[model samples]
Target: MKILSAFLMLLLPALVFGAEQTLVLDVSGHCGSCKKRIEKTVKAVDGTSSADWNKRTKKLTVSFDDEKTNKDAIVNAVLKVGHDADGKTADNEAYSNLPDCCQYRDE
Candidate 1:
C-alpha cells in the first residue's frame, strides 16, 4: 500500500498536467527588450507554461503541455512578434514593425 501510494504521488502530477515538451530554439534578437518580447510572446502561446530567452545566446527555451500545443504553434507565436525561430523567417511586415534596436536580421 505504501509503495502504491508513493507511485501514485509521482504519477499524479504528470496525469494532471499532461505531457510537457521543452524545446530550445535559435531565436533572433539583440538586447534586453528583445528577450522580454520573446519570452512574453512564447509564454502567451496556449499551453506554454514558461519561456526563457538568453540574449547573448539568442536561444529561447520554452515549456508547454504537448497535449494542448505543438512546436509550430510556439514558433509561430514568436514569429508573430517579429522574432525568427529555428531558422524560420519572420513576416516582413512584423519584422519591420520592431524597433530599430530590436531588429536582428541585419546583425
Candidate 2:
C-alpha cells in the first residue's frame, strides 16, 4: 500500500502540470481596441497565464491552467465581453454595445 501511494504521489504533479494548455479560438474583432478588449477579457479569467489576439487572423490564443479554468469558461468570458468565441456568440445587446470601430461583423 505504501509503494502504491508513493507511486501515485509521483504521478500527481505530472497529471496536474500536464493540464496546462494553450489554445487558439476563433474570436471576431476588427482593430486595436478590439484586441485590447479581447485580451483583457481573457486575462481577467482565473488561471490565464497569457492572452493575445491577432487582428489579421482574428484568433485569440490563450494559455491557462486547466485546473483553475477550462476552455469553455475562457470562451464564455470572451463572449461576455462582446466577441464571438469559437463555439459561442456574444449577446446581441452586448455586441451592439461595442464601439463602432470594434465591430467585426454586421448585425
Candidate 3:
C-alpha cells in the first residue's frame, strides 16, 4: 500500500503539470515590427508561456497552458492587436490602425 501511494504521488505532479500545449499557426504581417507585435500580443494572453513569429514563414509558434487559455483566445488576442492568425481576420478598425509598413493586405 505504501509503495502504491508513493507511486501515485510521483505521478500526480506529472499529470497536473502536463497541460502545456504548443501550436504553430499561420499569422499575417509584413515586417520586424509585425513580428514584435504578434509575439507580444500572444505572450500577453493569460496562459501563454511563449511566442515566436517568423517573418519569412509568417507562422507564429506559441506555447500556452491549456487550463487557463485556449487557441481561440490566443488567436483573438492576436487579432485584437491587428494581426490575422489561423484563418481569422482582425477587426477592420484594428487592421486599419496598424502602421503602413506593417500592413500585409496590399501585398
Candidate 4:
C-alpha cells in the first residue's frame, strides 16, 4: 500500500504536466542580455506559467496555459520588446530602439 501510494504521487505530477500544453519558441538574438530581455518579457505575459531562455542556443522555452494564450501571443510579446521568435521577424521600429550592442544583426 505504501509503495503504491508513493508511485501514484510521482505519477500524478507527470499526468497533470502532460495535459498542460507548452510552447517552445525559437528565438534569435545577440547575447546574454538579449536572452534576459526575451525571457523576462515573455514570462511577464499573462497566462505564461514559466519561461526560460537559453543564451547558448538563443531559444526561449515558454510554458503557458493554452486555454488562456496561444503561440502567436507569446511570439508577439517577445517582438514587442525588440526581439524575434517563432520565425516571425522582429518589429523593425522596436529593434531599432534597442541599444546598439543588443542588436543581433549584420551590417
Candidate 5:
C-alpha cells in the first residue's frame, strides 16, 4: 500500500547511512598543534574517512573502514607521533622526540 511504500522509503536511507561502529578515543596532549598533529596522523591511515581531535577534552574521533583498518592501528599511529591514545602507553622514542612545548611529561 502507499503507506507501506512511504515507510520503506524513509527507512532505506537510514539503513544505508548507518555506521558500523563509532570509535571515541582518548588522546593525551595539549594545544591546537597537538590536535593538528593527532588529526593529521590519523587521517594518514588509509581507511580513515575522517578524524578530529579536541584540545579541550583531549579526545579524538575517528571514522574508519572496519574492513581496511582497525582501532589498534589507529591508536598506534597516534602513539608513533608522540601522543597517547586509546589507553596505550606512549612510545618512549617518539615522546622524547617531540618539541619541548608539545611534551606532556612533568619534567
Candidate 6:
C-alpha cells in the first residue's frame, strides 16, 4: 500500500501539470513586421506560452496551455490582429487597414 501510494504521488504532478500543446497553423503576411505582428498577437492570448512566425513558410507555430486556450481562440486572436489563419481570413476592414508594407495579398 505504501509503495502504491508513493507511485501515485510521483505521478500526480504529471497529471496536474499537463504538457504544453504545440500547434502549427498557416498564417499569411509579409515582411519582418508581419512576423512580429503575428507572433505578438498569438502570445497576447491568455495561456499562450510562445509564438513563432516564419516569413518564408508563412506558418505560425504556437505553444499554449490548452486548459486556458485552444487553437480556435489563438487563430481568432491572430485574425483580429489582421492576419489570415488556417481557413479563416482576417476581417476585411482590418486587413485593408494594415500598412502597405505588411499587406500580403493585393486588394
TM-score of each: 0.86, 0.83, 0.91, 0.77, 0.79, 0.90
The candidate with the higher TM-score, 2 or 5, is 2
| Model 4, residue 77: C-alpha shift (Å) | 0.7
Cα lDDT of candidate 4 equals 0.82
In candidate 4, position 29 carries an lDDT of 83
How are the candidates ranked when ordered by TM-score, highest leading?
A: 3, 6, 1, 2, 5, 4
TM-score of 3: 0.91
Error of 2 at 19 (Å): 2.5
Error of 4 at 106 (Å): 1.1
lDDT of 3 by residue, 1-107 (tens): 99999999999987887488999999999999999899888998999999999999999999988888998999999999888889999998999999999988877
* lDDT of residue 59 for candidate 4: 73
Off by over 4 Å in 3: 1-3
On a 0 to 1 TM-score scale, where does candidate 1 land against the true structure?
Answer: 0.86
Candidate 6 local lDDT, 1-107, one digit each (tens): 99999999999987997578999999999999999888888889999999999999988899988888999999999888888899898999989888899988774
All models: lDDT?
Answer: 0.91, 0.90, 0.92, 0.82, 0.85, 0.90
Residue pairs clashing, model 6: none
For candidate 2, report its TM-score.
0.83
What's the residue-level lDDT of 13 in candidate 6? Answer: 82
**In what order do the candidates fall by lDDT, top score first?**
3, 1, 2, 6, 5, 4
Q: Which ten residues in a row have the lowest lDDT in candidate 5?
A: 13-22
Full-model lDDT, candidate 3: 0.92
Please, what are the lDDT tens digits per residue for candidate 4 over residues 10-104? 89986675345677778878877887788788878888888888877877888887667878888888988888788888889999988888888
Worst 10-residue stretch by lDDT in candidate 4? Answer: 14-23
